[model samples]
Target chain A: MSQVANRHDALDVVGAQWQAVSPRLVTLRRLSLSIVLVPAIVVLVIVLAVTQMWWPGLVAAALLVLWLLACVLIGRQVRAIRYARRDDDLVIRKGVLARRLVVIPYGRMQTVDVSVGPLERRFGLASLQFQTASASTNATLPGLVATEAQSVREELVRLGEKRMRRL
Target chain B: MTGLEPSISDEAASPLQWHRVHPATPLVRMWVALVALALFTLREVDELVSGGYREILALAVSWTAWAVLVGVIAAILTGFYISWRCTGYAVDDERIHFKQGVVWRTERTAPLDKIETIDVRRPLAARLIGLSQLRIEVAGGKDSYLELGFLRLADANVLRDELLTVARLHDRRPGAVTTPEAGIAAEHSSIPVEDALYEPSAVAAQHVLTIPNSRLFAAALLSGEFVTSVGVVIGGVIAVVITGSFATLAGVAALLWGFGGGAVKRFTRNFGFVVTKSDQGLRIGRGLFDHTMQSVPTERIHAIEVRQTVLHRLCQWWQIRATIAGYGEEGDETMLVPVATSDEVLNFLAHFGARWTDEQTIALLVQGMAGDRHQAGDAFQAVPQRARLWDPLGWVRQGHWADDDQVWLRHGRLQRAVSVIELAHCQSASVVQGPLDRKRSLASVEFGLVSGPVSKALDHLDESVAVDLAERSVAEDRRFRQAATAVAGKSGQVL
Candidate 1:
């Protein structure tokens, strides 16, 4: 009883093997942001050139600063993401400012999907997504080594099947 | 993944046959899409007619445009026809199969034994066309279901009965066909294309409860919608005072929805609502214009929640809801009692075999007991007085009870509620902490129901208490499941 009380005294503890996502996830996040942001910035700079206004140049600089801030935020967000496999459930901890730890039981899990986008594939990473009975419990573990993601998906499916069979 | 392949028995000697939906189905499904396309085309034609082209030949362009329009219409019709031809459904002895789409094809199947509910829906267009869609709700979750859309109304009803019959028969004996359900299904399935007709099978369900019009009206008046409406109206008045202008569409819409829309929706959905209980399970028949029949078996129910909004609390009324597997956001169907007294709510739960014999209620520091004195007692484990600031009026009411086969939770301030969750049906349990909670060393325990949108909670407990509650609830759930499995192993009967 004392151990249980002490374990949950600190809020951040999930107790065991909470692994952070691959550090390359930061690069993937930055790359995806730049792909969208770079084009928008270029379009804004072109508009500024056409308008030939000093204030517009200031606006373009402000936009560039916003872009840099977004990149930093994305990096922090990717870093904050972590996951752990429990005895009967999977726990995903995410978010920097308003943190959320979603725990999904194996019995409740319906599907374990692996999604890989072109950029993610180029970076040798895949996202493992879990679809549970409840929408809120559903979670995605982004930026895993492709093989690791596959193994996790296989393990989850196996565990889910076993639990459901017992039911 | 579980629903991809159709479930079939080892002795299935009959060849699997594929059949398409009615010819009118494609037209019905794509009518809205086609209408929008036509509207866009009409706007383009208007643009061409109104604009003056100085360098181009207007007469030649007009002729080309007409030709293009004709060709596009022909192409669309051909595509619809091809898509309709490709889409098909079949009834196997062990499963219901559906294959749809042209480019991105999907193959969906639902096992006979796992089928939860079979619904026959008739939309306005389908009604006019004398067609109905047979929706098969299965146990595996949201996406693991099949719909055989736009079959003849009679055929649809027969098909629903057939599937249900097969499922029931399967339940009684896994592979044996001693009953007449499979026989009827087989006979109906073998009917030729031109003469597919079967009589509406009489459903075997006993009349349980029929809500009177007066109670329905009271429920509407005491609903969360009514309270929300009142709040919105006050907010609108405040906004008008602040802005000194009424040029807000949102304000008008909010005002309209708060009063009339909410009341109307409640009245229409619950008007002439009736509940029936049978060996198959419980069925709720509701709706004024859009008549609906929702069915769920007794064992399929995940959890039963009893709530009281502020207005209802003042009136000593309670609303009881059941969360069944595979139902997502469909409110009226699961609501066993819309508005009833606390005693009445207990009686209703008794009818469903989830009677909480021990009466208990914690005295809130503020907003003390409202009504029905005999129904209230003290059984809940309360949060500390230090947590009072977290929920001023409701902090004392935030408590839980875990014993036997049930976990009882009490919460809410002006609108107090006591949600009764069966330990056997709970999907998951966890202790959640936020930044504010961490500062105060407080946490909340949430129990996830198998179905429904939100989790049941005992909010803002001491950190240690929350952890204890979570562990106890999980242990209870595990014990319940283990016992159920043991019973099944001994008797080959699953409850």
Candidate 2:
């Protein structure tokens, strides 16, 4: 918790608080990347076998291992991300290597969904999905504990409702 | 009017309970399912004759399982009839209540003031049966309204008239004088309720266009499966001629026959499309065997598209479709019309309060920007450097000021497209980013419109520019809406 606070303080120093997302979500991120890579590895092996190229198979395996390592490193970095609410907007700052900052105004929020998948369910963790009217633009803050996710969703909804009523 | 009792208060009596009055014959929707089952059985029998005894035995066991399906369908039909008889709706001075469902009965109640629009639809089969379906749309979620299917035609009309009268009376300003009962009595005595409610004057002039049967047939022919089947049939014919393989030829012939049958079924189901102008909105009713009636309000329309295929252009015909709010089972509910002339389109636009300037400059800009060619003209504006780089489709070219107030965007392929976004309707604008978009430093800016349910989006712009433009647009819209609302209030109109 102290480390998390220090990380947030560091993010604030850079004036990029909105780029923060939950650090614990790194587990889910790693799992998703692994799932994606399994099919790619299978396809690569099949292609190499079909071509009867031993060196190509070795190269493909090497690339897969490198990709997996990169993903794990990025996942660990993402796990350190955190977000905070500031006045009428929520700020998310994320990414270890290529950081991103997103500021979503409460009035623009259409729906706030708190979803817990099978793995997240075991860890009592959930993902907060923020939907806006524009289908193309959506923000997700994944890997918060279930209770925290619910609280965030409720806060966002209340803010959104207030904004709608003002309009 | 004199004999009618005063409006009943909700405190005095229970709200009317609505029932689901489905067709007495549930066989209509079930017939296809049954037919499919029977065909499956026949296929199994054919397989058994061809040395697939195990498949035949498995199919026979499944035939018993299908009995439950038949029973369930029959029960549903019976339940529908029973519920229809039992269901009723009542609107008191304050609340409207409806009761429905079969085994698990449900009741819904909402305030009368919450009602936005009441639609009454009569499909071909329902019309023949002298029945109509009534749906009430309200402000909440998609299913906020009550739907009562298969009401007697006369009863439906009476209900519609009564509801309309109540709505009008409730909406009347406080100081406005109520019309004398004598006038009401006179009007009611002379004009039938159906005629009064469904008068031609109540129908808007802009008729929705439906896609023609011939076009649908062309589309079917162009479908992947259709093309593949044709190829297979041609290949089989050539094979038979070259090698005299009777077995292969026979199999191909069967496949061809099945494909033809499927095409015929498709053609038959989509026959006799009609676009009817109704008081609620534009009702696009189509489908031969399985009827579909979709109503799109004029206010909810986002964009209207008029397209002409090469064949349609040669025939001097065009198809018009509108992007509307709300999701339907079939994705976008498109209304198809057989033919629409250019003159007719102008007239339709005028009726819908859309400006149709015949200025050659406007036309030239539309042609030059919407088309692939970059024709140099004094009237034409240059495409923004940011926009040109972002839009790979290159469909969206120059967006320029139109009539000093509106911004016009010209985009589309072959048919050519033009859109005029009024500053008044523009709400919040934003720049969107995806992984790919971030890499390109390009974003999509969406403009939220005030149109009910349906909103239009303008995509692809520089992120910073999009945010600035959106903020400005939203501010302008707010000011415009405020002024418009003030004027409406002064006029004693409920906007």
Error of 2 at A130 (Å): 2.6
lDDT of 1 by residue, B1-495 (tens): 344355443335766688778888987787788889989977776676665654235745667766887899899889989888888887766667787889988777787777767666666567678887877777665565677888887777567766665565554441222122332343335443223213334467687777787888877876767767777777777888898988664866767665768787898877787777665566676777555666566656667667777776667776777776555556556676677666565555544643433333223211122322123555566676777787777875777667655677777667666666765556556667777776677877777665663337777888777766555544653454454455445546443
Q: Evaluate residue B296 in candidate 1 and report its C-alpha lDDT on the 0 to 100 scale.
A: 63
In angstroms, how far off is B90's CA in candidate 2? 4.6
**Residue pairs with backbone atoms closer than 3 Å in model 1 (clashes):** B361-B377
Cα displacement (angstroms), candidate 1, residue B127, comes to 10
Expressed as tens digits, the lDDT of each residue in A88-162 for candidate 1 is 677676776555556666766778999999999999999998875545456789999899899999999997775
RMSD of each: 10.9, 11.6
DockQ of candidate 2 (2 decimals): 0.06
Per-model lDDT: 0.66, 0.53
Lowest summed lDDT across 10 adjacent residues in model 1 chain A is found at A1-10
Please report, as a value between 0 and 1, the fraction of native contacts recovered by candidate 2.
0.01
